[model samples]
Structures are given as C-alpha cells and as structure tokens.
Target: MQSFRTELENPIVERDIIELEQKIRLFREGKIPDEKFRSLRLARGVYGQRQPGVQMVRIKLPYGKMTLAQWKRISDISDEFSTGNLHLTTRQDIQVHFVSLDRTPELWSQLEQDDITIREACGNTVRNITASDAAGIDPDEPFDVTPYADAAFRYFLRNPICQDMGRKFKMSFSSSDKDTAFAYMHDVGVIPKIQLIDGKEVRGFKVMIAGGLGAQPQLAKVAFEFLPADQLIPYIESVLRVFDRHGERSSRHKARMKFLVQKIGMEAFEELVKEEFTAVKNKVVPIDADAWIATEPSETPGALPAYTIENPQQFEQWKKTNVFEQKQAGFFGAYVRVLLGNISSDISRLLIEKLQPVIADDVRVTVNQGLLLKFIRGEHLAYVYSQLEAVGLAAPGFNSVADITACPGTDTCNLGISSSTGIAVALEQVIQEEYPGLIYNTDIKIKISGCMNSCGQHGMANIGFHGSSMKSKGKVLPALQVLLGGGTMGNGAGRVADKVLKVPSKRGPDVLRSVLNDYATNLQEGELFNDYYDRRGERYFYDLLKPLADLTTLQDEDFIDWGQANDFATAIGVGECAGVVIDLIATLLYEAEEKLLLATESITAGAYADAIYHAYSCFVQSAKALLLDDGVSCNTQISIINDFEKHFEETRRFPVSNFKDMVLEINKQEPSAAFAEQYFQQAKEFYKASQQYRANKTAQTVNA
Candidate 1:
C-alpha cells in the first residue's frame, strides 16, 4: 500500500474525499508530488486551506445520530488512519482528519461497510441532518428524534430538486433545553416543547423556519406551534418543496431558505407548505423506535462501578463542570473537552481501544461536537479526566466560554472562505488575555465558518463570520461577512452573533477588535452580543461601524496581501444548453423576465410587441402556482422542456415563449415619432406606479 503525505502537505475534502486519496497514493509511490495534486483538484471543486498540512474533512452527518457500531468503527478508524481526532460538527456528524490521501478511500469504505454513506459530505448538497445527539438519551426529550431525522435524510439524500438549490438547506432536531447545538443557524429548526392541552401532555415540535447564516443571517421565524412527530417527515418535506420550487436560483449569494421565507413572509410560506405536504402525506411513514431500540447491542461488559473520591473540591468542580443528571436517574452525561477538541494520532488509538475497559461499552457524541462519555459511574470520572488530560484533552471550561469551536477554514480546506483555525486561535488568545471573568460567568461560544457553506457554523456563533469576496474597483478580494444574533431557535439554544460588519480577510482581527471594544464599553449589564442585537436591531450596531464598510476604509498597520486578489472584471455564468445548436434555439428567450427596461423598450414598437410584454408577465404570475405544484425531486435538476411550449400556446399574444428570447434588429425608417412618444408615455407610467408602491411600503414600515 502506498503512503499518503507525511503531514507536510495535504488536501481539503470538501467536494468529496475520493480524488484526494488517489493523489496521496500516487505521491507515496513517488509518481506525483505537490504540483500534480494541486492540478488534479484545481478544477472540479472549491479549494481553501488552514495551515498547510493538517487538513480538515467536513463530513455531512444530517440529523446527528449514527449507529453504535458506526461510532465505534469511526473511532477506531480515526486512530488507525487520521491523527486520531474526531470532531462532532454542529451539523450533527463527526469529522476526522490527518489521514493522508492514501487512507481516504479506506476510511470511506470502512464507513460504507457499516451501511453508512457520505456523498455530498462537503459539497453544496444539503449537509448532514443535525438532531440533538441526546434525543433518545435525554429524559426531557418528548420522543426519540432519531427516526424523524432518519426519514428526512433518506427522503432527501441525493434528491434531484435539492441538487442545484439557490443555496444549501439546513435542518435540526433537538429534544432538550441545551440549544447549544446552534439549531437556529439551520434553514429549519425543530424542537420538542411540551404544552398543556386539555391538561394532557402531547409530543410536538415547534417548527422554526428561515433562519440561516452567510453574508446575511436572520433568526428563524416560528412557522407552526405544534407539528406532530408522526407528520414531521411530511412537514419537513413540504418545507423543502416550497424552497425548492420558489427559492431564487440566479444569484448564488442569495440562494438560502432564510432569504425565501423572509421575502414571502412566514404566514404565506406556511400556507404553501401545507399545500405541498398534502401531496406527500400518504407516503409518510411512522417510526416505531422501541422496536428498533430493542435491537441495540446490550451494554458491553456490564456497567461501570461508582467510586467516591476524597477530593471534594476537584470532585465538586468536575461534577459541576463535567457531569449532568440524565433523564435516566444516576445516569449523568458529561462532555470531555479535548482542548480545541484536538486529539493526537496515538491518543485516538487508545481512546477507542481502551474505551471498552473504562466506561460502559456504549458511547455517544454530543451536538456540541465533542465526545460524550455517558453512563460513567462517579468512580470512573477521575480515571477518564486524568487520561484525557494526559493527552491534552482536558482543556478546562466544559461549556465555559473558553470552549470555543472552530471549523478548518482556509487553513486546510480548498473551498475555505477564511482561515478558520487561525481566527479561532487569535480569538481565544484575546479572550484569555483580556477577559478571564467572562469565561466563567457566562457561556460564550465563538464559532467560525470558513465559507458561507457553513462548515464551521459561523452563522450560529455568539459571533460569526462567513467567507466572502471583498471586491473594490470591480475586483475580488478576501473578506468575511460578520453574522450575529443566531443561536438555537429553541428555548435551549442560545442566540448567535448578529452580523455587525463585513471586513476584509486580513482586517478581520482589527474589525473584531473595534467591535469588541464597543461591546465592552456600551453593553448593558449582563448583555451578550445576542442580547444587544435582540434589544437593539442588528442594524443599530452595524450602522455604528459604517466606516468599516465604506470604500475609504483603510487597511490596518499590519496589512499584507495574501492569496490571489478577487477579479472584478466582466463575468459570465456557464451552464448546460449554451447556444442550443438548433443553430441555437431558433431564437433566444433570455429568461422572459419583466425588467423595467423591457417594458419601456417594448412600447417603442407599434403597440403590437408592447401588449405582448404585459401579457407575458401576467401569464407568469398566474401560472406560478401550477409551476411549483408538482414538487421537484430533492436531489436532481428539473428540466422543463415543454413548460415554455405550453405557455406559448396559452399566451399566444406574447412575442416570446418556450424559454425563447427575442432580439429585434429593427431597421428603423427614420426615428419614428410615434414610437418615441409611446416609449416616454410607458416610462412615465412605470415611474409613477413604482413611486406609489415605494411610498406605500415605506408608510407600512413606519407604522409597524
């Protein structure tokens, strides 16, 4: 077998991990080196990085729960292949890394053998479903959230409709009060909150819609009060159906569910979902969890014994910081801080190897993206903590502010928008040096997403940043969109940082400095950034730092250019069906949109084409319902070859139909006075209508 890289050079596994392992194999055989690997991948995917060697593979594990054997398999694989590091991502899956290109396919196959798959783990597809890892384990949970998560994953995975979404779709499942999972950052967040109805407790999820992170971030809107668990799958499918059918597909930047829900208004969107869910209601399946749970392997080698320790101070601190009483009495859950959640190559091996002998055979990862050693007797606490510390895994602050999480940004990701690891390191340093009390007094979490794709979940951070292109003078440059006021959409989830500023990649440190300084100076007592944004709208603080966003914003004293500058020149969007070589489409239908210019340009023609433009726009609006009725498949693209043809026959008066655009090479016989007069008339009328609409909207806003 060929060896992969020796930690000196590596590749990001964003788009997928297959090609990466192939390169590593060839290199180990001395057939290819650095340049070859770069050229091999430079084409098919987005490339970014952290430092240079330690690469991060952000795997998609939607709904967060996996089989016990799957967990053990990954744990063992991490030891044998990677640097023995496993990171539980906020999106509800674990990420392992440091395995060179050589071991990638092996790791993938190992996962595959267990009937687990990871396609689109890194790509633009809907990432892993995120559900509270403690769903079945937490007593406070309304029901086992795993089945709903599982059904959603199966129904949507690789569905055509979800393939080319305007942007990614995120969903979450939580049962407890620990919204620490950042469920609010998702496109859809589901939490079980018991409400009294007729003095009886019923299980239902408070459905949250629209909330997401990227250049623009917004808290989710509550869409439904109580959606029964049985209908959860259908309800979620309906939500995606609305998004898939109505979401904007043109601008890559504006393609998130949050944008769609915001533009249409929550009530209207909910009605649309109800209409769509009605279509798939019969296909829904109810999960019988007890039957499945009965199959779980019996607890390995009996239970761990409880021991009373002599050191009350240390025990008390550990109990306070490490343990929690589970829904099952005397069975407490605790998180083991792995210090930035990093593990060594050797430590990973021993962790899985010795776990059977230590705690009970069963172990589960937490939504906090950390390994959760559950069912540990009080006696095992000392031994586990000691061993974890021996490997530098004992970084204090189990939920303390210092337990900041960061995804691998440009440091090791090919598609990374920023240096996530680097920013995390710097941010932690500043926190430790500047404010020690905040770490203990309040729970502060700083999460960073390298790109808008949300590998790091920066959108839900107490403070967050999405990778962006900071262009000037018509060019591309590195920048980060600061997202704020996103957290768990449920009672347990905390609000993340709201976007207060968009700063250049290099200037992020300084910009954060300014924001922090302001936060410290102006914060209300006991107010976090989330509270500040809540009390005062996001704009109130962002407007304060307008100077940072202005073109005149100067670089800092430590400014230095890094990577290639963004291009601001002309651009083109390339896709299938270029010039339909039917000698190209018979004629161009340039999307048949109703831009203002089109309306004005049409009237210049002799009333014939002018009437057509108005008729076409009306036809489109009328047909909107039918167009979105069929429900596009979630994993593929929808090609409507005859949609335009049918529209053409019905709206025969229009100049263009059937996705066909028109170009008029008019040989004007003198500047026709008739056309000129009619053109101005239309423009004036359009202007008047636009002005009235704007005024009405402004008045409504002011009143609200």
Candidate 2:
C-alpha cells in the first residue's frame, strides 16, 4: 500500500484516506481484529464480496448528481483499480466491484480529485441521500428539493452522532406528489409541498418516518403532513438521536427504524423524538436553493452538428420512452438505460464526450438505475438519441418493464444466494422480444435481488423477484421468490409486494410470460397491475403459476444456477451490512477506552450530545466486556445492562450500585456540558473498575 499524504487537496479527506490505509495495513498485519476492521472499512465503503480477496467500493453520489468530470474520474478509477465496470445502485450511488481492498485508499483519493466521495456510503451510518432524478426539471414539482437533500447529506456526512449507529439509515426526497423518489419506503422520506398561509406561499415537506424493506417490509408513518422546510434538518437530527439511543442492536433484521417504530407505536416514538429536540444543535436549518441551482456547462458546442438517424423508428421509440419534457420550455430530460445498471468504463467516457454538446452539466442518476440527462434542446433530442445509440446506450423503456432493476447478486455481493443479474437479463429479453409493446409501459416495474435484502428495491416493484433456492431429491436448485401487486400509490403512499410464490430460477422468464399473458388476456380496461392483483388476490396468481413450480419436470441443468458452470450450491457468506460481532474481550476494552477519549474530545469541541453518547458507549462497552468475562454473552446494549445487574451488580462481585439506572442516566439527563463531563467521569470510573476486576478474576483462575 502507498501513502496519500499530500495527494488530496482536502486535508480532511486526505487524512481519512490515510487513516483507512493505516487501518488496512494494521488489519493485514493481524494487529486489528476482523470484526473491528470490517466495521472500519465498511464505513469507508470498502465492502467484502462473496469472492475472497476482493472488495466492492460504493461511491456516494449525493442526490445522485455528478458532473461529467466526476463521472470520467470514476470511470478512470474503475478502469485502473476495479473490474472496469460501474454498477449503478437503486439508491443512486455507483459501485465498482472486484477491486483489491489494499488499493481502496488510492482509488478513494483519485475519486476525491473530482469532488466525488465514498464516505458513509455503507455500514451503520446514513447511506446516500436520494432524491427524484428529475428534481429541478420536473414539470409537476412544486419546487426542487435538491438543496434540502444536499443539506441533509452534508450535515450528516461526518456527524459524530451517526458515525456508529445500530444500523444503516436511509432517506429520500420526492420532487412532486408523483412520489418518483418513493419517499414512503425509507427511514426518513420527504416529499416537497407548498402551503398557502395568509396569501403567502410557504415551502414545506410531507415527512414520513420508519419505513424500510428487507426480508420484512414496513410502510413509513406520516410524521407530519406539512413540516416547514426550515425545520427539516432539526427534525431529522432529533429522529436520528432517538433512533441511535433506543433502536435494536442485537438482531440485524430488527435493527432498522421500522422495527423500532413498530415495537413502540408512532406516538411513543414521536415522544422520544420530541425529547431529543433540546439536544439537537440546530433548531432550524434554512436551505438556500440558489446555492445549488442548476447551471449550464461553461463549455458547450457552439453549433449543433448535422446528424442522420439510421434507424428512424427506433429513434422515435427511444424518444417516446426515454425522453421527458422538462419544466423549462423546449428543454428535455433524456434517460439513458444501461442494462442491469452495469456500464463499461469505455462507454461511460464516450457518453461524457458525446453528450457534452447538448446536455446540461448536471447529470442526475435515476433511482431505477439509469442516467437522467437534463436541459437537452427539442431539436437535439434526435442528436442525443443518435449519440447514445452509437454508444449502445439508447435503450428505450428507461423505467419501463424492459429495463429490469437488479443487484449484483452472486457476481459480487456476499449475501447473494443466486444470480440476480443473470435472471434479470433473461427477464429483460422476455420483455424486449416477446412483450415488445410493454416497452412504453412505465406502470409495471420488474426488479430482482440476489437475496431477500431489497438492495435492488424489489419490495416496491409491481412485479418483484428475490433470489432463493429449493431442495428436491437431495439436490439444491436455484429459485426466485416471486412477488406481486406492490408499487407507488402516489402522495407518499406505497405498497410492499406480497410474496406470491417461489419458482425455479431458470423459469424466471416463463414466470414473467405467464403473468403478462394472464394480465393481457383477462385484464379489464384502465386497471393497473396492483388493482388487478387486488381484485384477483394472491391465490389466483399462485394457482395460475403453480405448474411452473413442479419439481417432477426438472432437468439435470435445473440443478445449475445462472451464470455458473457448476451445479447449484448455497454459498452464502456472513453479511457485513451490520458489523460482525467481536467476542474478544481485549478489543471491547480497547474500544471502550477509545470511546472515552472521543468523549473528552467531543466535550472540548462543544458537541454536548456527541460527547454524552460517546460516554454512554464507553459505559456499555466496558460493562459488556466485564460481563463477557463471566461467560455471560449478551446481544443488545439494553440487555447487557440488565444481565450485568443480575450477574455482577446483584452479587456484589463488581463495584456498582443500581447498574441499570447508572447506564440509563444518559437518556434521562439533559445533554449539557455539566452532564457530559459528569457522564465522562462515570464512564471512566466504570472502565477502570471493570479492568481491575477482570485482572483479579484472571489471577484467581490462574491460581486454581
């Protein structure tokens, strides 16, 4: 590994890269524990993949907007360090997989040269803050939500409060009531709204909270029908504070904000959020839209070049499906559909070169894993189409059924059970070849995930499939859990797709054909897929597709998974979305000491809430370490306090009084300087005593 001491312009970012390099070096030298190193690397966007000795680097694209320069920079980085493929995610970020982990710091530094980032793109922190790709250009939008989304992304990027939370948090912003961003299915969903008060128009947001999709999907509750735009940041900060303190940490599945809100009703959650108001540093965060206003590129083609369309009908189809008339008169938003969200680095640079003439400088990444090119002239539509077609990116049906959304399942992800990409390709071919007319149908979305985790946003798809497997005669076979009747209901309401049935993965195309054929033959006029599904119910679809799931008709090739040469086998690896568990007592004690130091530093910086939380972590980690010494393994922080009270505090084996009360004091007391200092003292005393007690126990064990 090489040093990045002076390579980066931003000293802060340079230090971050350098620190990552140091950590990776330490991890390689066997100095740091695996679990601890995994957490650190994940926060920096270095993710371990299903394949050993390679990593997936997720690049955080705030609001999914990136300049041409940044895109080219990413392309260059991918070409040099990764597999020369850029995978756009459903969250509007770009991921490059199969990269050497030791080279990540260099890659991150190179990306930073063009103002791109990967920090906080993964792990137990706020993921990329996504918004409607057509935000500024949407004709139906009340106002652009880009500035507000950017504000949230900037505020929390390095905020101490969210550095190491119980689980990853997600947020989204929709430009209009159409809910193009699918704000209803996020941890914090905000839809832009305008309220007239005494003849004056005031900007606000319809806020939703605690919505998430995993193996289990939950809809977000309306936090406020109309929260003033200025209060958005403060409200989010408070909600995060509440979630960090009270959210589940033991079970990864139940650690999302959705579970916390479900466990405790919305009313109770709101009360807890209200309690965090005083601790939040900002009462109101005003967004200046002018600061982030879209502007044309400084250098553009002086004259439009003459071009002839070789395929006139295809170009027209591309325009019909891929082009959208922007709010600006005569301007258009062109969607470039990259199949499976995988674009080669060579094609990516060509796009930057070709589209520079007519398109605006602002290129937004659509949530459906496509590119949104803004500010194209009406006459230039055919030209843009030509340029894109030449580069093999002029695929019609940008958000239509043909453009299937999928994750890199077995290709790169650790949690993938089957080949999501392979299945997606087959389904897309089904739509393109058989159901050609459906290319213009944006109502039906087909999304796939390699696993039950909704990274591909399968839960929100009208027709969704997640990778799985089945057993027949002692052989494992690739399977997909088919889901139906779920999609955006508009106005911040959405449906989670119901798992209808499971079928062999190779039958994915057949499954689609059956569903579409059934819809085409038996559908009523003017009814959407969800309505049809509701009218018929789950059993109707199950019985209709039941014959496809028959194992008796299976062939020898059925045992083989997609995109593989060998027979199917469940090769699932431990997921690292949430950090791995560390059973080493020494690591816990070291982390506790580190937290205490962080608390002291935070107090000096006047971040009272941060300091208090650090102190709280110190207490919990130290106590948990001591409890582990007694063979009392606990999962959650709350449980650790309880068990410590029973096993140590009650027996008078450890020097403590009212253990629960002592640990829980963090929430009851105000986050003031005095309290922060006092909490720091308490945590220090507890850590010291716990270490001494552990030493005494070790001595006794040795004597015995």
Using lDDT as the measure, the top candidate is 2
In model 2, which residue pairs have backbone atoms overlapping below 3 Å?
Answer: none
Give lDDT tens digits, candidate 2, residues 1-704.
55555477788798889889999999888999888899889999989988899999999998899998989999999999987899988999999988998889988988999999999998999999999999888999999899899899999987876877789999999999999888889999999999998899999999998999989999989999999999999999989888877777767788899998998899999998987787676778998887776656334458766766778898889989998898888788889998888899999898888778788888888898899999888877888888888888888888998999998898888899889999998888888888899998999999999999988889989999999999999899999999998899988999999999999999988999999999988889998888999999999999999999999999988888888889999999989877665668989898899899888888998988778888888888888898787788766666788888999889998889987987777767778889889888999999999889888988999999
lDDT of 1 by residue, 540-624 (tens): 7687666667656544321322332543222212211001111111011111223334445545544433333232332332233
- Sum up the clashes in candidate 1: 54
The 10-residue segment with the lowest total lDDT in model 1: 577-586
Report model 2's TM-score to 2 decimal places.
0.95
Model 1 per-residue lDDT at 253: 59
Candidates in order have lDDT scores of 0.54, 0.88
Tell me the deviation in Å of residue 341 in model 2.
0.3
RMSD of each: 16.0, 2.2
